[model samples]
Target: MKKKFKHIKESQLTITELMLPSHSNFSGKIHGGHILNLMDQIAFACASKHSENYCVTASVNKVDFLNPIEVGELVTLKASINYTGRTSMVVGLRVESENIRTGEKKHCNSSYFTMVAKDEAGKSAPIPGIILTTKDEIRRFARSITRQNEGRHRTSRFSSKIFKTDAYIHLLEESNSKIELK
Candidate 1:
Protein backbone atom coordinates (compact mmCIF):
# COMPACT_ATOMS: atom_id res chain seq x y z
CA MET A 1 0.00 0.00 0.00
CA LYS A 2 1.10 3.55 -0.64
CA LYS A 3 2.43 5.12 2.51
CA LYS A 4 -0.45 6.97 4.14
CA PHE A 5 1.96 9.33 5.87
CA LYS A 6 4.56 11.01 3.72
CA HIS A 7 6.62 14.10 4.54
CA ILE A 8 7.72 16.45 1.84
CA LYS A 9 11.19 17.11 3.12
CA GLU A 10 13.30 19.56 1.11
CA SER A 11 10.90 19.43 -1.80
CA GLN A 12 11.71 21.83 -4.65
CA LEU A 13 11.12 22.22 -8.36
CA THR A 14 13.05 24.58 -10.58
CA ILE A 15 12.67 25.69 -14.19
CA THR A 16 14.86 28.03 -16.13
CA GLU A 17 14.13 29.69 -19.45
CA LEU A 18 15.41 32.65 -21.38
CA MET A 19 13.02 35.50 -21.99
CA LEU A 20 12.32 35.04 -25.70
CA PRO A 21 11.35 37.84 -28.04
CA SER A 22 7.78 36.59 -27.96
CA HIS A 23 7.69 36.75 -24.17
CA SER A 24 8.52 40.42 -23.78
CA ASN A 25 6.28 43.44 -23.64
CA PHE A 26 6.69 46.72 -25.53
CA SER A 27 8.31 48.13 -22.38
CA GLY A 28 10.89 45.28 -22.51
CA LYS A 29 9.84 43.79 -19.18
CA ILE A 30 8.43 40.30 -18.82
CA HIS A 31 4.69 40.34 -18.28
CA GLY A 32 3.34 39.71 -14.79
CA GLY A 33 0.80 37.27 -16.19
CA HIS A 34 3.55 35.19 -17.75
CA ILE A 35 5.42 34.98 -14.46
CA LEU A 36 2.18 34.09 -12.69
CA ASN A 37 1.52 31.27 -15.14
CA LEU A 38 4.98 29.87 -14.51
CA MET A 39 4.47 30.18 -10.79
CA ASP A 40 1.21 28.22 -11.04
CA GLN A 41 2.89 25.48 -13.03
CA ILE A 42 5.72 25.09 -10.52
CA ALA A 43 3.31 25.22 -7.59
CA PHE A 44 1.18 22.46 -9.11
CA ALA A 45 4.22 20.28 -9.63
CA CYS A 46 5.28 20.66 -6.01
CA ALA A 47 1.80 20.01 -4.64
CA SER A 48 1.22 17.00 -6.88
CA LYS A 49 4.47 15.39 -5.84
CA HIS A 50 3.42 15.61 -2.21
CA SER A 51 -0.13 14.50 -2.85
CA GLU A 52 0.76 11.88 -5.46
CA ASN A 53 -2.12 13.03 -7.68
CA TYR A 54 -3.12 15.61 -10.20
CA CYS A 55 -3.60 19.01 -8.62
CA VAL A 56 -5.58 22.05 -9.69
CA THR A 57 -5.02 25.60 -8.48
CA ALA A 58 -7.71 26.69 -6.06
CA SER A 59 -6.43 30.19 -5.25
CA VAL A 60 -3.40 32.46 -5.27
CA ASN A 61 -2.74 33.76 -1.81
CA LYS A 62 -0.41 36.51 -2.90
CA VAL A 63 1.83 37.65 -5.78
CA ASP A 64 4.34 40.40 -5.48
CA PHE A 65 6.79 41.57 -8.09
CA LEU A 66 10.02 42.84 -6.60
CA ASN A 67 11.87 43.58 -9.81
CA PRO A 68 11.49 43.60 -13.56
CA ILE A 69 13.16 40.80 -15.55
CA GLU A 70 15.08 41.78 -18.65
CA VAL A 71 14.54 40.01 -21.96
CA GLY A 72 17.93 38.30 -22.07
CA GLU A 73 17.87 37.08 -18.49
CA LEU A 74 17.12 33.51 -17.54
CA VAL A 75 13.99 33.23 -15.43
CA THR A 76 14.12 30.55 -12.78
CA LEU A 77 11.05 29.41 -10.87
CA LYS A 78 11.41 27.53 -7.57
CA ALA A 79 8.48 26.03 -5.70
CA SER A 80 7.76 23.70 -2.79
CA ILE A 81 4.73 22.39 -0.99
CA ASN A 82 4.75 24.07 2.41
CA TYR A 83 1.51 22.93 3.93
CA THR A 84 -1.45 20.59 3.35
CA GLY A 85 -5.03 20.14 4.45
CA ARG A 86 -7.75 17.55 4.01
CA THR A 87 -8.25 18.50 0.36
CA SER A 88 -5.83 21.34 -0.26
CA MET A 89 -2.10 22.00 -0.42
CA VAL A 90 -0.34 25.33 -0.14
CA VAL A 91 2.73 25.80 -2.30
CA GLY A 92 5.20 28.65 -2.05
CA LEU A 93 6.93 29.88 -5.20
CA ARG A 94 9.74 32.28 -5.89
CA VAL A 95 10.91 33.57 -9.25
CA GLU A 96 14.44 34.72 -9.88
CA SER A 97 16.07 36.35 -12.88
CA GLU A 98 19.65 35.49 -13.68
CA ASN A 99 21.93 37.11 -16.18
CA ILE A 100 23.57 34.10 -17.77
CA ARG A 101 26.42 36.11 -19.17
CA THR A 102 27.23 37.81 -15.89
CA GLY A 103 26.13 34.93 -13.64
CA GLU A 104 24.13 37.31 -11.46
CA LYS A 105 20.73 36.44 -9.97
CA LYS A 106 18.01 38.46 -8.28
CA HIS A 107 14.65 37.62 -6.81
CA CYS A 108 11.90 39.00 -9.01
CA ASN A 109 8.70 37.70 -7.54
CA SER A 110 7.20 35.61 -4.75
CA SER A 111 3.77 34.01 -4.39
CA TYR A 112 1.74 31.35 -2.65
CA PHE A 113 -0.57 29.01 -4.53
CA THR A 114 -3.26 26.75 -3.17
CA MET A 115 -3.96 23.54 -5.05
CA VAL A 116 -6.53 20.77 -4.61
CA ALA A 117 -5.81 17.20 -5.54
CA LYS A 118 -8.12 15.64 -8.08
CA ASP A 119 -9.50 12.12 -8.36
CA GLU A 120 -9.79 10.03 -11.50
CA ALA A 121 -13.16 11.62 -12.18
CA GLY A 122 -11.51 15.08 -12.08
CA LYS A 123 -13.21 15.96 -8.84
CA SER A 124 -11.58 17.37 -5.72
CA ALA A 125 -9.80 14.70 -3.67
CA PRO A 126 -8.28 14.54 -0.23
CA ILE A 127 -4.50 14.80 0.17
CA PRO A 128 -2.30 13.24 2.81
CA GLY A 129 -1.21 15.55 5.59
CA ILE A 130 2.29 17.07 5.68
CA ILE A 131 4.88 16.53 8.39
CA LEU A 132 7.12 19.49 9.13
CA THR A 133 10.74 18.37 9.45
CA THR A 134 12.95 21.43 9.78
CA LYS A 135 12.52 24.64 11.73
CA ASP A 136 12.13 26.65 8.55
CA GLU A 137 9.51 24.23 7.26
CA ILE A 138 7.66 24.42 10.55
CA ARG A 139 7.72 28.22 10.45
CA ARG A 140 6.42 28.21 6.90
CA PHE A 141 3.66 25.82 7.91
CA ALA A 142 2.69 28.12 10.74
CA ARG A 143 2.58 31.13 8.43
CA SER A 144 0.37 29.18 6.03
CA ILE A 145 -2.02 28.32 8.82
CA THR A 146 -2.14 31.97 9.87
CA ARG A 147 -2.88 33.04 6.33
CA GLN A 148 -5.61 30.46 5.94
CA ASN A 149 -7.26 31.51 9.17
CA GLU A 150 -7.11 35.14 8.10
CA GLY A 151 -8.64 34.29 4.73
CA ARG A 152 -11.46 32.36 6.41
CA HIS A 153 -12.17 35.19 8.82
CA ARG A 154 -12.19 37.75 6.04
CA THR A 155 -14.42 35.63 3.85
CA SER A 156 -16.86 34.92 6.62
CA ARG A 157 -17.11 38.58 7.48
CA PHE A 158 -17.79 39.77 3.93
CA SER A 159 -19.39 36.73 2.41
CA SER A 160 -22.84 37.97 3.21
CA LYS A 161 -22.19 41.00 1.06
CA ILE A 162 -20.36 39.16 -1.68
CA PHE A 163 -22.66 36.14 -1.84
CA LYS A 164 -25.79 37.67 -0.45
CA THR A 165 -27.51 37.47 -3.82
CA ASP A 166 -29.80 34.48 -4.01
CA ALA A 167 -28.02 32.85 -6.92
CA TYR A 168 -24.58 33.32 -5.39
CA ILE A 169 -25.79 32.03 -2.04
CA HIS A 170 -27.09 28.91 -3.73
CA LEU A 171 -23.75 28.38 -5.48
CA LEU A 172 -21.82 28.91 -2.25
CA GLU A 173 -24.02 26.42 -0.43
CA GLU A 174 -23.49 23.86 -3.16
CA SER A 175 -19.73 24.34 -3.05
CA ASN A 176 -19.68 24.01 0.72
CA SER A 177 -21.66 20.77 0.48
CA LYS A 178 -19.23 19.33 -2.03
CA ILE A 179 -16.26 20.31 0.11
CA GLU A 180 -17.83 18.60 3.12
CA LEU A 181 -18.19 15.41 1.11
CA LYS A 182 -14.42 15.33 0.56
Candidate 2:
Protein backbone atom coordinates (compact mmCIF):
# COMPACT_ATOMS: atom_id res chain seq x y z
CA MET A 1 0.00 0.00 0.00
CA LYS A 2 1.14 3.49 -0.85
CA LYS A 3 1.24 6.20 1.76
CA LYS A 4 -0.69 9.38 1.10
CA PHE A 5 1.22 12.54 0.25
CA LYS A 6 0.76 15.59 2.43
CA HIS A 7 1.27 19.31 1.87
CA ILE A 8 3.57 21.59 3.82
CA LYS A 9 0.68 23.66 5.13
CA GLU A 10 -1.00 20.54 6.45
CA SER A 11 1.58 19.99 9.17
CA GLN A 12 2.90 23.52 9.67
CA LEU A 13 2.83 24.71 13.27
CA THR A 14 3.54 27.89 15.19
CA ILE A 15 3.99 28.45 18.90
CA THR A 16 4.30 31.73 20.77
CA GLU A 17 5.30 31.99 24.39
CA LEU A 18 6.20 34.84 26.64
CA MET A 19 9.77 34.60 27.79
CA LEU A 20 9.97 34.56 31.59
CA PRO A 21 12.74 35.38 34.00
CA SER A 22 12.90 31.73 34.91
CA HIS A 23 13.82 30.86 31.32
CA SER A 24 16.76 33.23 31.37
CA ASN A 25 20.40 32.44 31.93
CA PHE A 26 23.03 34.15 34.06
CA SER A 27 23.22 37.00 31.55
CA GLY A 28 19.46 37.55 31.93
CA LYS A 29 18.71 36.40 28.39
CA ILE A 30 16.54 33.49 27.41
CA HIS A 31 18.53 30.25 27.63
CA GLY A 32 19.55 28.56 24.39
CA GLY A 33 18.81 25.18 25.92
CA HIS A 34 15.27 26.25 26.64
CA ILE A 35 14.81 27.36 23.06
CA LEU A 36 16.24 24.05 21.85
CA ASN A 37 13.71 22.20 23.99
CA LEU A 38 10.90 24.20 22.44
CA MET A 39 12.30 23.55 18.96
CA ASP A 40 12.31 19.81 19.61
CA GLN A 41 8.71 19.94 20.78
CA ILE A 42 7.56 21.82 17.70
CA ALA A 43 9.53 19.52 15.39
CA PHE A 44 7.96 16.47 16.94
CA ALA A 45 4.53 18.02 16.61
CA CYS A 46 5.00 18.91 12.96
CA ALA A 47 6.49 15.54 12.00
CA SER A 48 3.79 13.58 13.82
CA LYS A 49 1.09 15.70 12.28
CA HIS A 50 2.39 14.97 8.81
CA SER A 51 3.18 11.28 9.32
CA GLU A 52 0.18 10.55 11.54
CA ASN A 53 2.53 8.37 13.58
CA TYR A 54 4.77 8.68 16.60
CA CYS A 55 8.00 10.43 15.72
CA VAL A 56 11.33 10.74 17.46
CA THR A 57 14.21 13.10 16.91
CA ALA A 58 16.79 11.25 14.83
CA SER A 59 19.23 14.13 14.64
CA VAL A 60 19.47 17.90 14.97
CA ASN A 61 21.36 19.16 11.94
CA LYS A 62 21.88 22.87 12.52
CA VAL A 63 21.07 25.27 15.33
CA ASP A 64 22.47 28.74 14.76
CA PHE A 65 21.47 31.41 17.27
CA LEU A 66 21.38 34.68 15.40
CA ASN A 67 20.11 36.86 18.24
CA PRO A 68 19.62 36.77 21.98
CA ILE A 69 16.03 36.74 23.19
CA GLU A 70 15.13 38.99 26.08
CA VAL A 71 13.07 37.67 28.98
CA GLY A 72 10.37 40.28 28.48
CA GLU A 73 9.88 39.55 24.81
CA LEU A 74 7.46 37.21 23.10
CA VAL A 75 9.16 34.26 21.38
CA THR A 76 7.56 32.53 18.47
CA LEU A 77 8.59 29.24 16.86
CA LYS A 78 7.47 28.02 13.49
CA ALA A 79 7.98 24.49 12.22
CA SER A 80 7.27 22.56 9.07
CA ILE A 81 8.48 19.49 7.25
CA ASN A 82 11.18 20.37 4.72
CA TYR A 83 11.81 16.89 3.42
CA THR A 84 10.60 13.34 4.02
CA GLY A 85 12.38 10.04 3.71
CA ARG A 86 11.08 6.49 4.00
CA THR A 87 10.61 6.82 7.73
CA SER A 88 12.13 10.20 8.48
CA MET A 89 11.38 13.86 7.93
CA VAL A 90 13.50 16.96 8.30
CA VAL A 91 11.62 19.59 10.28
CA GLY A 92 12.73 23.14 9.57
CA LEU A 93 12.35 25.46 12.52
CA ARG A 94 12.58 29.20 12.87
CA VAL A 95 12.57 31.11 16.12
CA GLU A 96 11.84 34.80 16.42
CA SER A 97 11.52 37.24 19.29
CA GLU A 98 9.28 40.29 19.46
CA ASN A 99 9.44 43.14 21.91
CA ILE A 100 5.94 43.67 23.29
CA ARG A 101 6.16 47.43 23.62
CA THR A 102 8.31 48.34 20.64
CA GLY A 103 6.83 45.75 18.27
CA GLU A 104 10.34 44.89 17.21
CA LYS A 105 11.05 41.42 15.92
CA LYS A 106 14.35 39.61 15.62
CA HIS A 107 15.29 36.28 14.16
CA CYS A 108 16.69 34.40 17.09
CA ASN A 109 17.49 31.00 15.62
CA SER A 110 17.05 28.54 12.80
CA SER A 111 17.37 24.77 13.07
CA TYR A 112 16.77 21.55 11.22
CA PHE A 113 15.66 18.40 13.02
CA THR A 114 15.47 14.98 11.44
CA MET A 115 12.62 12.98 12.90
CA VAL A 116 11.83 9.31 12.33
CA ALA A 117 8.31 8.00 12.42
CA LYS A 118 7.74 4.96 14.60
CA ASP A 119 5.20 2.19 14.48
CA GLU A 120 3.36 0.59 17.40
CA ALA A 121 6.30 -1.75 17.82
CA GLY A 122 8.69 1.18 18.10
CA LYS A 123 10.18 0.32 14.72
CA SER A 124 10.66 2.66 11.77
CA ALA A 125 7.45 3.36 9.87
CA PRO A 126 6.63 4.57 6.42
CA ILE A 127 5.87 8.27 6.12
CA PRO A 128 3.97 10.36 3.63
CA GLY A 129 5.79 12.28 0.90
CA ILE A 130 5.74 16.06 0.75
CA ILE A 131 3.60 17.84 -1.80
CA LEU A 132 5.58 20.84 -3.02
CA THR A 133 3.28 23.43 -4.50
CA THR A 134 5.36 26.59 -4.70
CA LYS A 135 8.88 27.63 -5.64
CA ASP A 136 9.83 28.16 -2.05
CA GLU A 137 8.59 24.72 -1.14
CA ILE A 138 10.56 23.20 -3.98
CA ARG A 139 13.68 25.05 -2.93
CA ARG A 140 13.41 23.88 0.66
CA PHE A 141 12.95 20.28 -0.40
CA ALA A 142 15.97 20.56 -2.71
CA ARG A 143 18.09 22.05 0.02
CA SER A 144 17.17 19.22 2.36
CA ILE A 145 18.41 16.71 -0.17
CA THR A 146 21.71 18.55 -0.42
CA ARG A 147 22.04 18.66 3.34
CA GLN A 148 21.33 14.94 3.65
CA ASN A 149 23.90 14.08 1.02
CA GLU A 150 26.53 16.27 2.63
CA GLY A 151 25.85 14.68 6.01
CA ARG A 152 26.26 11.19 4.58
CA HIS A 153 29.48 12.18 2.90
CA ARG A 154 30.81 13.69 6.08
CA THR A 155 29.96 10.61 8.13
CA SER A 156 31.66 8.33 5.67
CA ARG A 157 34.74 10.50 5.36
CA PHE A 158 35.12 10.94 9.11
CA SER A 159 34.40 7.36 10.09
CA SER A 160 37.04 5.80 12.37
CA LYS A 161 38.55 3.58 9.69
CA ILE A 162 38.38 6.11 6.85
CA PHE A 163 39.69 9.14 8.71
CA LYS A 164 43.43 9.88 8.54
CA THR A 165 44.44 11.97 11.53
CA ASP A 166 47.96 12.63 10.30
CA ALA A 167 46.71 14.14 7.05
CA TYR A 168 44.81 16.87 8.90
CA ILE A 169 47.35 17.50 11.67
CA HIS A 170 48.39 20.80 10.12
CA LEU A 171 44.76 22.03 10.22
CA LEU A 172 44.66 21.43 13.95
CA GLU A 173 47.99 23.23 14.43
CA GLU A 174 46.31 26.39 13.09
CA SER A 175 43.89 26.30 16.03
CA ASN A 176 44.45 26.99 19.73
CA SER A 177 44.41 23.28 20.57
CA LYS A 178 47.73 21.68 21.56
CA ILE A 179 48.54 18.19 20.33
CA GLU A 180 49.66 16.32 23.44
CA LEU A 181 49.97 13.05 21.61
CA LYS A 182 50.85 10.29 24.03
Candidate 3:
Protein backbone atom coordinates (compact mmCIF):
# COMPACT_ATOMS: atom_id res chain seq x y z
CA MET A 1 0.00 0.00 0.00
CA LYS A 2 1.18 3.53 -0.75
CA LYS A 3 1.82 5.74 2.25
CA LYS A 4 -0.18 8.89 2.59
CA PHE A 5 1.53 12.21 3.10
CA LYS A 6 1.00 13.67 6.50
CA HIS A 7 0.75 17.37 7.10
CA ILE A 8 4.29 18.41 7.81
CA LYS A 9 4.59 20.36 11.02
CA GLU A 10 7.08 23.17 11.39
CA SER A 11 8.94 21.03 13.89
CA GLN A 12 9.78 18.46 11.20
CA LEU A 13 12.90 20.25 10.03
CA THR A 14 15.31 22.48 11.88
CA ILE A 15 16.38 25.84 10.50
CA THR A 16 19.57 25.58 8.50
CA GLU A 17 22.20 28.32 8.47
CA LEU A 18 24.70 29.52 5.88
CA MET A 19 27.21 31.96 7.28
CA LEU A 20 28.46 34.82 5.17
CA PRO A 21 31.66 36.78 5.58
CA SER A 22 31.91 40.52 5.06
CA HIS A 23 33.79 39.88 1.82
CA SER A 24 30.95 37.76 0.46
CA ASN A 25 29.29 40.87 -0.86
CA PHE A 26 30.03 44.56 -1.45
CA SER A 27 26.71 45.94 -0.15
CA GLY A 28 27.19 44.42 3.33
CA LYS A 29 23.98 42.47 2.80
CA ILE A 30 23.79 38.81 1.98
CA HIS A 31 23.96 38.35 -1.75
CA GLY A 32 20.93 37.01 -3.59
CA GLY A 33 23.03 34.22 -5.07
CA HIS A 34 24.24 33.26 -1.61
CA ILE A 35 20.69 33.10 -0.34
CA LEU A 36 19.60 31.09 -3.38
CA ASN A 37 22.37 28.61 -2.78
CA LEU A 38 21.21 28.18 0.77
CA MET A 39 17.63 27.77 -0.36
CA ASP A 40 18.65 25.12 -2.88
CA GLN A 41 20.40 23.14 -0.19
CA ILE A 42 17.41 23.26 2.08
CA ALA A 43 15.03 22.37 -0.71
CA PHE A 44 17.10 19.39 -1.78
CA ALA A 45 17.23 18.18 1.79
CA CYS A 46 13.48 18.41 2.16
CA ALA A 47 12.79 16.74 -1.15
CA SER A 48 15.23 13.93 -0.49
CA LYS A 49 13.70 13.27 2.89
CA HIS A 50 10.24 13.28 1.38
CA SER A 51 11.16 11.05 -1.55
CA GLU A 52 14.12 9.19 -0.10
CA ASN A 53 16.18 9.76 -3.24
CA TYR A 54 18.88 11.98 -4.67
CA CYS A 55 17.14 15.10 -5.85
CA VAL A 56 18.48 17.91 -8.00
CA THR A 57 17.07 21.38 -8.54
CA ALA A 58 15.47 21.60 -11.98
CA SER A 59 14.25 25.18 -11.79
CA VAL A 60 13.35 28.01 -9.42
CA ASN A 61 9.83 29.17 -10.24
CA LYS A 62 9.91 32.42 -8.28
CA VAL A 63 11.99 34.25 -5.70
CA ASP A 64 10.87 37.26 -3.74
CA PHE A 65 13.32 39.04 -1.50
CA LEU A 66 11.39 40.96 1.10
CA ASN A 67 14.25 42.15 3.27
CA PRO A 68 18.00 42.24 3.36
CA ILE A 69 20.05 40.11 5.68
CA GLU A 70 22.89 41.86 7.38
CA VAL A 71 26.39 40.42 7.68
CA GLY A 72 26.22 39.48 11.35
CA GLU A 73 22.66 38.17 11.31
CA LEU A 74 22.10 34.44 11.13
CA VAL A 75 20.52 33.49 7.82
CA THR A 76 18.06 30.69 8.53
CA LEU A 77 16.56 28.71 5.65
CA LYS A 78 13.47 26.54 6.12
CA ALA A 79 11.95 24.38 3.42
CA SER A 80 9.34 21.66 2.88
CA ILE A 81 8.15 19.54 0.01
CA ASN A 82 4.84 21.10 -0.90
CA TYR A 83 3.95 19.16 -4.04
CA THR A 84 5.14 16.25 -6.08
CA GLY A 85 4.68 15.08 -9.65
CA ARG A 86 5.68 11.97 -11.59
CA THR A 87 9.24 13.23 -12.01
CA SER A 88 9.21 16.59 -10.29
CA MET A 89 8.77 17.97 -6.80
CA VAL A 90 8.08 21.52 -5.75
CA VAL A 91 9.68 22.67 -2.54
CA GLY A 92 8.72 25.85 -0.74
CA LEU A 93 11.44 27.74 1.04
CA ARG A 94 11.35 30.66 3.42
CA VAL A 95 14.46 32.47 4.50
CA GLU A 96 14.69 34.53 7.65
CA SER A 97 17.39 36.50 9.34
CA GLU A 98 17.79 36.70 13.07
CA ASN A 99 20.06 38.71 15.31
CA ILE A 100 21.92 36.34 17.58
CA ARG A 101 22.08 38.84 20.43
CA THR A 102 18.77 40.66 20.30
CA GLY A 103 16.70 37.72 19.01
CA GLU A 104 14.99 39.89 16.42
CA LYS A 105 13.90 38.07 13.30
CA LYS A 106 12.79 39.21 9.86
CA HIS A 107 11.53 37.45 6.78
CA CYS A 108 14.24 37.81 4.20
CA ASN A 109 12.96 35.88 1.19
CA SER A 110 10.57 33.24 -0.13
CA SER A 111 10.87 30.98 -3.18
CA TYR A 112 9.52 27.86 -4.85
CA PHE A 113 11.99 25.40 -6.27
CA THR A 114 11.29 22.47 -8.57
CA MET A 115 13.49 19.44 -8.12
CA VAL A 116 13.85 16.14 -9.98
CA ALA A 117 15.01 12.93 -8.47
CA LYS A 118 17.62 10.95 -10.40
CA ASP A 119 18.33 7.26 -10.63
CA GLU A 120 21.70 5.53 -10.67
CA ALA A 121 22.18 6.36 -14.34
CA GLY A 122 21.21 9.98 -13.84
CA LYS A 123 17.86 9.65 -15.55
CA SER A 124 14.77 11.37 -14.25
CA ALA A 125 13.14 9.19 -11.60
CA PRO A 126 9.62 9.04 -10.26
CA ILE A 127 9.03 10.49 -6.83
CA PRO A 128 6.61 9.36 -4.16
CA GLY A 129 3.25 11.05 -4.46
CA ILE A 130 2.18 13.73 -2.01
CA ILE A 131 -1.12 13.64 -0.14
CA LEU A 132 -2.84 16.84 0.88
CA THR A 133 -3.58 16.38 4.53
CA THR A 134 -4.96 19.86 5.17
CA LYS A 135 -7.08 22.43 3.46
CA ASP A 136 -4.20 24.89 3.24
CA GLU A 137 -1.94 22.25 1.75
CA ILE A 138 -4.61 21.32 -0.78
CA ARG A 139 -4.93 24.93 -1.89
CA ARG A 140 -1.19 25.38 -2.19
CA PHE A 141 -0.81 22.10 -4.06
CA ALA A 142 -3.46 23.12 -6.56
CA ARG A 143 -1.72 26.43 -7.18
CA SER A 144 1.60 24.72 -7.70
CA ILE A 145 0.15 22.31 -10.25
CA THR A 146 -1.41 25.16 -12.18
CA ARG A 147 1.83 27.09 -12.17
CA GLN A 148 3.86 24.08 -13.29
CA ASN A 149 1.50 23.37 -16.20
CA GLU A 150 1.64 27.00 -17.32
CA GLY A 151 5.42 27.01 -17.13
CA ARG A 152 5.66 23.79 -19.11
CA HIS A 153 3.51 25.21 -21.89
CA ARG A 154 5.55 28.39 -22.04
CA THR A 155 8.83 26.49 -22.09
CA SER A 156 7.62 24.23 -24.85
CA ARG A 157 6.70 27.18 -27.04
CA PHE A 158 9.99 28.94 -26.32
CA SER A 159 12.02 25.85 -27.11
CA SER A 160 10.21 25.29 -30.37
CA LYS A 161 10.80 28.87 -31.43
CA ILE A 162 14.44 28.67 -30.47
CA PHE A 163 14.90 25.49 -32.47
CA LYS A 164 13.54 27.20 -35.59
CA THR A 165 16.04 30.05 -35.34
CA ASP A 166 19.33 29.47 -37.13
CA ALA A 167 21.14 31.92 -34.88
CA TYR A 168 20.15 30.00 -31.78
CA ILE A 169 21.13 26.70 -33.36
CA HIS A 170 24.51 28.15 -34.28
CA LEU A 171 24.98 29.44 -30.75
CA LEU A 172 24.07 26.07 -29.31
CA GLU A 173 26.49 24.32 -31.66
CA GLU A 174 29.28 26.69 -30.67
CA SER A 175 28.63 26.10 -26.99
CA ASN A 176 28.52 22.37 -27.57
CA SER A 177 31.87 22.48 -29.35
CA LYS A 178 33.43 24.29 -26.41
CA ILE A 179 32.11 21.66 -24.03
CA GLU A 180 33.39 18.87 -26.27
CA LEU A 181 36.88 20.36 -26.37
CA LYS A 182 36.97 20.84 -22.62
Tell me, by TM-score, which candidate is best: 2
Per-residue lDDT of model 3, residues 1-182, tens digit only: 67445345531354756455842578677788888877888888888777677989989987888987877788878787778788778888888889888999999887898989888898887777776778878887888989988998878867854555554556676564554433
In angstroms, give how far residue 154 of model 1 lies from its true place.
Answer: 1.4
Q: TM-score for every candidate vs. truth?
A: 0.82, 0.96, 0.76
lDDT of candidate 2 vs native? 0.94
Q: Which candidate is the best by lDDT?
A: 2
Those runs of model 2 whose alpha carbons end farther than 4 Å from true positions after fitting are none
Please report, as a residue range, the 10-residue window in candidate 1 with the lowest summed lDDT: 173-182
TM-score of 2: 0.96
Candidate 1 vs candidate 2: the lDDT winner is 2
C-alpha lDDT values of all predictions: 0.84, 0.94, 0.77
Candidate 1 clash figure, as a count: 0
Model 1 / residue 73 / CA error / Å: 0.4
Model 1, residue pairs in steric clash? none
Once model 1 is optimally superposed onto the true structure by TM-score, how far is the C-alpha of residue 5 displaced, in angstroms?
2.5
lDDT of 2 by residue, 37-138 (tens): 999999999999999999999999878899999989999999999999899999999999999999999999998999999999999999999999999998
